[model samples]
Target: MTETSTEGTGTIEALSLVPKAEARQSMKDFKSDQEVRWCPGCGDYAVLAAVQGFMPELGLAKENIVFVSGIGCSSRFPYYMNTYGMHSIHGRAPAIATGLASSRRDLSVWVVTGDGDALSIGGNHLIHALRRNVNLKILLFNNRIYGLTKGQYSPPRRSARSPSRRRWARWTRPSTRCRSPSARRRRSWRGRWTPTASI
Candidate 1:
């Protein structure tokens, strides 16, 4: 008598089987015990809550996520997250996050920065990261003023108020209509390819 292999049958059975239980993990699992220290009415609280709420959807291992931040009010993000993080110098979060993401593909890298911290001292770093398409998520909080620095005017504000009316006019132009044809082409290309690629 010949005996048939049960391995294929077992594999088929496993493939057809459904999960017996729902996920036990909750958003609270990602919540850090650290006290949220943002001032009342600060937008940081909303940003923090949004990040925490969205994080669980990634379903990543807690240790495999990293948050890097520059010196500013929003830079305190790394401290509130339960995952691994680094609070870096002013306007250096993008560079640090780029390094981390490039070196560790298994990790989810996020950079938390403020308008002044990123667009002022870190502008070059931010542009390079975006241009290179670095595998990092940047959360730039633009509150128009420097919150951590006691409400000083920021780079965005300076640009808006500068004597160069031409620059202000260019900046104020509607982005979608004002972009160059090359930029429009790039956007169209990305819109067509990214959806299928993501799936």
Candidate 2:
């Protein structure tokens, strides 16, 4: 915006309408001192890094932001962020985070949950949060998987399963995408294992 003064010397000065940012933090400022334990190529690492980088743009203080996570691979996300966070109960991140947000309106709460942890055990809580229109930033990492424990069914298998998939999934064991076919080979021949996709 510019305005001219005619009373004295005619002059125009530029003024910015935008407010100054509250924080001047770099991406490194958001990084926690703890180590990132996700697998070498896990997509969660990318998500974490992206969120860390994006936080600076918000100009919000790290102390005011909170991250809540439930059980599964993403539950450890809190450990990697410098902001306030909670490793909440299994499938209960939504409920816990909602309560926290409601009670402390000043705090910015973010929910981090994998497909299985959210859609299965925590389905009701997730629905409740959405139905109530609660203020929150929910990060649903829908890789369609439950990679933490091997015995549990995956998100893709449980939520959107066909009848045929149900029958097969019940019998076949669950597996992690991170495991190499060679490392998870079917058999060991001569004390050596080779890659094989066959189950």
Candidate 3:
């Protein structure tokens, strides 16, 4: 195992001689007993499921997994996971995860953040973590609106639109390429009404 620093710099000093199958089983043992809780139609459900399913593939010991999240509707991720986790303050998940990732070589750190909690006030921390590549899996939930704040507009919202709607548009942009032409056309209707420049 190797130890890292809070500054996002580190080196792997030793190789684990653990066999692949044994390591995989060890990781699987770390999964927790909590039931997932997210809105029926919310994207968070998928994100959570994906993470949980993917985690065991790493084949690390259960003690090596850590999930940290900032406050938001999405921040509840830690509660649903069986592994070690921290439901941190608003917009501070990355910073907290960064520190943990830098200092703990045995742990696989993951940060779960939302658009409001991350981009709004935690933007600086997010950027630094990404740039430094601090051996973390940063899962950003970009729903556009501040769901925990009762559907309010978030920082990622466009300036020209209502805060609530602007966030939706911002979140949807990344999916445009994957969408069917008909879906893209439907989205274009909103573009015309709101003006593409606003987005």
RMSD (CA, Å), each prediction: 12.1, 16.5, 11.0
Model 2, 1-199: lDDT tens per residue? 1121323121111111113347588999889999899878887887888789888877667888889999988889999999899998989998998788777765667899887887778877876665443455678776655677654466345433666545546454443321324323311111211112121
For candidate 2, the 10 contiguous residues with the lowest summed lDDT are 8-17
Residue 113 local lDDT, model 2: 87
Ranked by lDDT, top first = 2, 1, 3
Candidate 1 regions with alpha-carbon error over 4 angstroms: 1-24, 158-199
**Clashing pairs counted in every model:** 0, 0, 2
Candidate 3 lDDT by residue in tens digits, 1-199: 2233333234232113212335345333544677666777777766666666766766655566778999888888888877789998978888899888777655678788887888778877776665555566667776657775576666655443665555445443322111334323322111111111221
TM-score of 2: 0.69
Question: With candidate 3 superimposed using the best TM-score fit, by how many Å does residue 98's alpha carbon deviate from the native?
Answer: 1.2
lDDT, candidate 1, at 67: 93
lDDT of 1: 0.65
Instruction: Give all TM-scores, in the order shown.
Output: 0.69, 0.69, 0.67
On a 0 to 1 TM-score scale, where does candidate 3 land against the true structure? Answer: 0.67
Per-residue lDDT of candidate 1, residues 1-199 (tens digit): 1011222232223212212213544578768888988888776777787778877765566777789999988888888988899999988888988887767766667788887888778877877665555456677777767776665566555345555543433343222211334323322112211111222
